[model samples]
Target chain A: MFKALSVREPQPACADVEALSETPVETLLELIDKAQQPPWVGMRAASCLIQGHADAVQDTLVDWVQQEDSRGFAILVLNQIDTLPQPVAIAVATQALAGPYASDATSRIAKSTNPALLALVP
Target chain B: MFRLPFALVALILLPGCELLTGLLNGGSGMLETRTSSVQSQDGIATIDVDVSGESAFQLTATSGQLLAVEAVNAPDGSQPLYWDDWSGVNSLTSAVWLEGKDTVLNWPVRQADGNLSDGTWTVDVAVVDDQGYYTDDQVDVVLKLKDDSDLSTGTVNARIVYADGLKQDSVVTAGVQDAVTRWAEIWAPYGINLETSYEDSSFSTDQPFPGEGSEQAEVSSGANGSEITVLITETIDGSTDYYGIAGGIPGTLDYTDHALVIVSWLTNAGGDGEFSDDDIRLFGETLAHEVGHYMGLFHPVETTFDYWDALDDTDDCGGQSACESALGDNLMFPYPVCDWTSCTPQDQLTSQQAGVNQRYTGTL
Candidate 1:
């Protein structure tokens, strides 16, 4: 199946932005859908703010991390989290992101948990 | 400026002291239309607004009470953009709208206090267009009588906790923290508070001799509410077996108010590091993006629920190559591309997140 993954809320879905930069994993990360609209902006951003949709997506993409803390993974939220209990959300994402941990090149590269990786940061 | 009869204007505003009285939404500064007319037996006042598309609108009375909104259709099937519920309206939260339909929003509620309610309020609404950028409209209302939530009380509060992981100074650590902080500000208006200890600590315990460490963010919520714990790591070396993993590294874990757990890993080593950036922007996005997962959010180009059938039929990244075409050119597109010299070209936060930030922190 096809999918678009991102980090945080739709306003700045880091997943889709970094999709191009991402090293493909044999195990899929996410699927693509219409409710997400503009494709660039995920469902989260598509359902809330309508102003400067492209601009918002562009700004989020232009901003990338040179210095990274290689600890946990990132997740993309595609729904309205307000009415729902926050604790529920935290629990869901943890499991989802961790599920794909071992199938990617990064996970393979990180097998040794090498400190050299930090030095490798640009 | 489209104007109606003077009586209609008076009919709409004169009842400042009515059971429930207020505009459906603040003037977007985008467009406007005013009308005064028949406030029939429905006990609800109807204000004919001027607008076309429908997403969601929020209005605040001078009483500071929130008036939930929906853009729906009128009885005539003309599909209105606004409406008012003065007498029998219940909590505005009761509204549910269906897409692909033309309609006007119907919302208004009378607090239990008896007297009319009024105050300053900022309306958090979603344009529901392509990107869904968080948009807001602020307005003031005055009540002829004062009605309260019974206790004659009113005040809403919220909290923001930084996802746990990085320390205050380490380049990677600090970079992560700063990024989350900025995200909190963006979501403040949603009544979420942004909290960070800013203390210098690490999540990775045994980093590789020459490798960067790891970290983790754990989110928890209950009667005490929600909080994220960022766990940074110590150092380690990668000169060992291809399969032997070492000490703890930065790993992200997201859970719902306690639902699913998403564990992620990061690094900046050989094979063209995807970690670093021209700026800390990626780190910041990572913070917010990951948090979105813990919050029960999924990906945009969803392959699961069949949510992508009607799209432009392009790839996720919106680029020419398979990597780009697969994920498209947007940040939240779908795929994660790793090039030593590139970054996500179309990344950005969803609109609701912007509202979440605005509702509390009062910043972007």
Candidate 2:
């Protein structure tokens, strides 16, 4: 994952994100915490976690959504997810409606392909 | 030592002298454009351009073959200039040698003293490869000249392409349109008006950056005519880290994949993942900067500090602090100079820089 994220070209670096979906939830969380370079690794890691271990990292994702620093990455993860669980979808829509990032929330909701998340968007 | 065939003659004449003089003396800064087509026989085509007292002049040559501006001759047929003249080491020796189908030659040609190489200029175009000239290649050469009545104004159109579902209508205040408005204001000082139109793309939210994959080329498939294409996507190359990238240094206006300017949605959001006033400002700068590259302007000085662009007005200040203080305000400076609090405004363009931008084939 480190090697993959370190590469400058985004195609390979981002392709590695899909492979990391099989990685352990704890390992993925650790990688996200330590990821810095390329500036998008944390967001990609969050995406990987959401894709493979949504139930396991659900609370952590919710917590990230509420925080200012990590909220963008968390929202980006939600934006890419093919299927958002009912609870996570409700939590994100509520937080998005009542935050400094309401515009970002609206943009994400408008572009989301997931019907459940789209239905939840106000 | 090569003489241009007499068949080549000036297709367009200069505007009236009084109006031109008034233009130089702060009158209406309208732009005059002349376009002519020549058929290459035995791999070479030549044309002549007549110049008067225009404030600035730029010539663009486009063909389907690998193209190069073989030579240029002054009106009096003296002091002929050739492709080999530019070493590209300094302002005086540098030139815009675009390798693809489209190429441009801005007048003045690196003269720091601002000497315009005006009046009956002869230009030679030829098909060539790394090995040698390709004589059998026959193609149509389209030459365009943009003559600015004054240094104060010019205009170029932009075609904005949005990835699937990312299209923000003209009324959308917070997204691409707002940033484009800021982009226009940044160029207003140079008298370059960036007129714009919008389109929708069938591509997904996350696609390859320009030159990364075929998607960008596909996105640009709809591009036609002289307007530049700007593609807005959620993430380029599956990552939101990149601010934007241009397909070429002086990207072509003809409809080809290599002629694209792309921006990332998340990268435009800046660090906060939300569009603040500062982020919007940065977004606007990025759009202008990237399009500046597409229009053939290099960084006044690269991030390395040792290298510099081919312009006289821009200083060659080396090291971090000196470069930051000297060139941080220029539009084409590499990377924004920012602290934890704020970033410096990069909105200035030297006369030569603006000349190059206006010289682009797309800058109508």
Candidate 3:
């Protein structure tokens, strides 16, 4: 009359995106650039960038938009471009539209109500 | 590169599209279900499950106290089975023993011959007390069986819920629909058809995904009848990184508070506004994977590598490399096997796995 118990593994803990909010903008960018980090880490880092470092990360975001590997995360950041300052949003979208992801960039820009960003679409 | 051939091979191995076509044409529909109350006599409950020319048979026992399968004797009084005894070794007679209120047994699990041995089989059940001893208790068991003589065809209804205006967002809606189509294809081989519908809602939750809370309770309560409700949210608890999670193994088709499945739109989209081809494939696999859990399929080998499912066909492969090599393409692998470039499609379901899905009480 031996009984066996069923055992299941718990899911791994998700990376703490909130913790990265306090990280330096440079460190967040570095984290995003690290190929070893899981895609989520780069995504969380991009969120941290948009929250407070949009102006500083504009160039880097545009660079990621051009690259194949990081384009998805960069596009993710642009999805919330409305949260950034008007000037920074335009700057990033302009550079993004010039990249290989032009169509994707155009769609994200077209959704914006900002006149400056929409004018750049056509 | 290396990903293309694997993808092509997976495509070649997929069952004919006719399975889905037949379902759309109104072939064998959802399996019918019957629930019966079994009272314990001297700490054991004897119940009879009549196959009666059915394609398959599944018995799920639930009680206020924990329940376990103590014996299963066929019509000939042979193959006396014990719970979790020689499990994964004795595939035909091995039973799954879970220390919970509910346990389901699907006949012909992992049996290569697919012989259901139709007859009125007697299953003896017993309750385990708080201290893990056999105790007398009344148990309610539900039997899900396919109709008449159809062995390989069954339908599952899915109601996908869009939260935070995701359904209104055309990009998200198209991506989700594409994923659902792919999910149907993945299950086509097992003759399991996914009849999908969509819903729109706004649910705000601050808790992490899979955490039990009022918000999840409210979402799960939306499920009724035989459809499994899948709720797609913006990002679980403010992060867009985690994949989807199921409320429980075998989430109910009833109007209970714990009968929901959850997927994150942003995570499935890889945080992008639009989903790429790879994103769609991953999303489809995620949908199938999570729904598999809701239908009572466990990961062949858990992430810990030590714990394994109760199935005989799934190997107890250890370590990341070993498990990936062994069960990477399995539909219920713990996570997607991928590196810098692409992921291997996790679309394959073993016979036992398919049996488990078909045996789910919600299949109706």
RMSD in angstroms between candidate 3 and the native structure over all alpha carbons: 12.1
Estimate the lDDT of model 1. Answer: 0.27
lDDT of every predicted structure (CA atoms): 0.27, 0.61, 0.64
- In candidate 1, how many Å is residue B56 off? 15
lDDT of 3 at B231: 86
The alpha-carbon deviation from the true structure for residue B39 of candidate 3, after best TM-score superposition, in angstroms, is 3.5
Leading candidate by lDDT: 3
* Residue range B1-364, candidate 3, lDDT tens digits: 0100010000001122111111112245445556667777776778777666655555667778766567777777775466545343222321234345655565544334255566777877766676666677877766655453544567788889888556777878998999999999999999898998888877752235553546766666665456788888766655554557775565554344455777776666653446788778878988998899877777887666776776777887888789989998998887766653466788998887887787654553
lDDT score at residue B230, model 3, on the 0-100 scale: 87
TM-score of 2: 0.64
Candidate 1 per-residue lDDT, tens place, B256-319, comes to 1121122122321111122344334544444444444333222444423233311232233322
Measured with C-alpha atoms, the lDDT of residue B199 in candidate 1 is 35
The clash count for each model shown is: 201, 0, 0
Error of 2 at A30 (Å): 14
Candidate 1 segments whose C-alpha is farther than 4 A from its true place: A1-122, B1-169, B181-195, B199-224, B232-275, B303-331, B337-340, B350-364
What 10-residue stretch in candidate 2 chain A is worst by lDDT? A5-14
